[model samples]
Target: MARTSRAPRADAARNRDKLLAAAAKVFGERGLDAPLEEVARRAEVSIGTLYNHFPARRDLIDAIFPVRLAALEQVADAALAEADPWKGFVLFVEGLFALQARDRGLNDVLARRYPASPELSGACHRGFVHLVEIIERARGAGLREDFEAQDMAPLMWAMSQVIRETADVAPDAWRRFLAFHLDGLRAGAAGPLPAGPLTEEQARGRPGEPAGSPGR
Candidate 1:
């Protein structure tokens, strides 16, 4: 007997898309531990349908990761186009952090594994290179201080680590933290950003911040 391939019904295609979108959100928030069955439920599909599309968890995760990267690239590219390099760098970092905060699973799982690989690291390196170019341009105009490109790489890595593992810190303090991080990189050699891998126990951010706290 010969193998027969069948085109999925139209409804099956819609269900597959819904599953991917919901799984992206669920996995982004909760990590890939989210059950496929649960994803199917959230997407209003049946488990059989999900399995039909994503046969394995890794398949789903790997697929979603690239899609997420594309979205981030678009946002960062727009931010990098700002006239002020300093402002552009700050906004780019801000957008980057927001994506991680909203999707801790991606930061914790995919990012940690990829950053250590040079080929994998290059994708992210582009973002930092773009940031450094902006900062240098700002400095040339005396709108910013002298900052090296190399500094932004580890700053980005450290900030992502801090955001991912330190869930105890209240969310509202992120902008203040970003400001603190950026301030150190400004023209004058300010002090250091606390070396991250900062556990929740380490951050002294406001506990249960008020509604109007900065960046809320």
Candidate 2:
């Protein structure tokens, strides 16, 4: 007879679930770099147990973010369906900013790449392509001929910072900032800027640097 695969032990399964829940909470509050021990502590488990369930930080991130990434893609798809290119572009940007404002973990995910996680990397790549399409459509509609898709990274990075700093004192502060930036992006907003946009590779975040490192 062929050997049968064994199911996870009941306690092991429960521990995994607890770890995931705690990780989502901690990562949401502190970003992906939060200490693993905190997740274990919140899950009411030992650190060793947490390691047993997820051998690496990337493993834990992979488990927690697939749904969130899928949701982001859905938002992109919705924006792409809008008939007006400028409207679509605005909707896409606002949707992305809203997502970052709502979920700290997702904010980090958008701004950074965990190189070991292929799934996350692929999802981010797709999102980048979608952004290019949105930018092209808007340009074709005479909205912002000077705009470049690569400009999105720095913009998102700045917006994330705005959200982080003003979350408590002025939760809607990013709206004011975004409005000013958007006006500058309009077709005839001003004379051409001196510096060129960053390359896509640069916008993707530099290796060994935190996502959206301004120094880059």
Candidate 3:
């Protein structure tokens, strides 16, 4: 007879929950590369228990970031639903930067690729598609004629850098930089450019590259 898998025991389930919660806390403070040992310690569990639950860092990351990824999609949806495309575009950009400013883990997630995690990779691709639609709508409404869908990734990458550098010292400083970038993105602000925007594949990064590659 074939054997069926049994559900986890109550204590084991509790330990799993603790580990996930601790991981969320640790990754929020540090980046996704934060130590798994720290997460185990924070959960008051042994490293063995954490490994039992997550098996690997990618597994832990895959478990912890879905909610944040969903939140980003919701922001995109909300912005897309706005009647004014310009307002929608602005809201999308501002919302993204605000989330990154607050969550270091999310900043890392947004700024990188995770090829090994299919769920996270799919979510990122979907988010990029949403951005493409949003940008198209904004352009249709006569905003940022020079802007391309691929430009969004580079912009977010730049903002992530600014957020990383200034977040501790001036948590809100990214806002000022974003505002300046927004100004430059305005319709009438278009001027002769030095070079064309990066291609979508280029903006999304090459395979096997580091997670937080600017292309991502």
Candidate 4:
């Protein structure tokens, strides 16, 4: 009787794994908004089974994305491990955009297409902590002093569009764009700009409020 009960539990676990794998493949190919039916189809599971594993679209995304995005932390650690701060910063930035270019689902996550996913939010917050260290280290080593962590918001948003627009037609187009941006970020490239950098709130998708303040 115990063996019989364990068999059912093991089967359920297998089904859940299949659903997650299918969802990752589907979402990576087609972005986060891809239909649930495709995930179920790819998993070779009934729609009921897929729903049993993940009741809502966000639930499926929450399960898959946080794990995938954990790779970002690995990238960050690699960057920090580099001997040269400027090189580390470049590695971090290039690594990030490379991941975005490769994965449609991650591109959507970086773009904040689904803001309601608490898992993704937590992942992003952790990424930002690494970004701050990367930015400051780079600044000390010839990155523009005035460039703030918040500036990464616009840079990411811009690159997100470039990746989307050029993914099929010119998959490496973002590389050229990134080269130009990296040059502009050098200390010698600094010049007076028309506007100031974004606030921390703005960087985090909550504009018009000071950092650490109430949300309303």
Off by over 4 Å in 1: 1-8, 45-48, 113-129, 139-150, 166-169, 190-216
How much does candidate 1 score in TM-score?
Answer: 0.64
Q: What digit string (tens of lDDT, one per residue) describes model 3 on residues 1-216? A: 123333446678999999989989998887777788899999999999998888878888888786677788888989999999999999999998888887898888888734436788787777656887888889947577879987887888889889988978998999999999988888888788899999867987723446453221
Q: Where does model 2 exceed 4 Å of error?
A: 1-8, 113-116, 140-142, 207-216
Candidate 4, residue 79: lDDT: 95
Model 1 has an lDDT value of: 0.60
lDDT, model 2, position 53 = 85
lDDT of 4 by residue, 16-135 (tens): 999999989988887777888888999889999988877778888888888788888988999999989999999999999999989988887887766546767997777656998998
Ranking according to TM-score, highest score first = 4, 3, 2, 1
Model 2, residue 41: what's the lDDT? 98
Q: In order, what lDDT does every prediction score?
A: 0.60, 0.79, 0.81, 0.85
Instruction: Tell me the alpha-carbon RMSD of every candidate.
Output: 9.1, 4.3, 4.3, 5.3
In terms of lDDT, the best-performing candidate is 4
For 105-126, candidate 1 gives per-residue lDDT tens digits of 5664324532123433444444
- State the displacement of the C-alpha of residue 128, model 4, in Å, after optimal TM-score superposition: 3.0
Per-model TM values vs. the true structure: 0.64, 0.84, 0.87, 0.90
TM-score of 4: 0.90
lDDT accuracy of residue 106 in candidate 1 = 61
Compared with the true structure, the alpha-carbon lDDT of candidate 3 equals 0.81
Q: How far is candidate 1 from the true structure (C-alpha RMSD, Å)?
A: 9.1
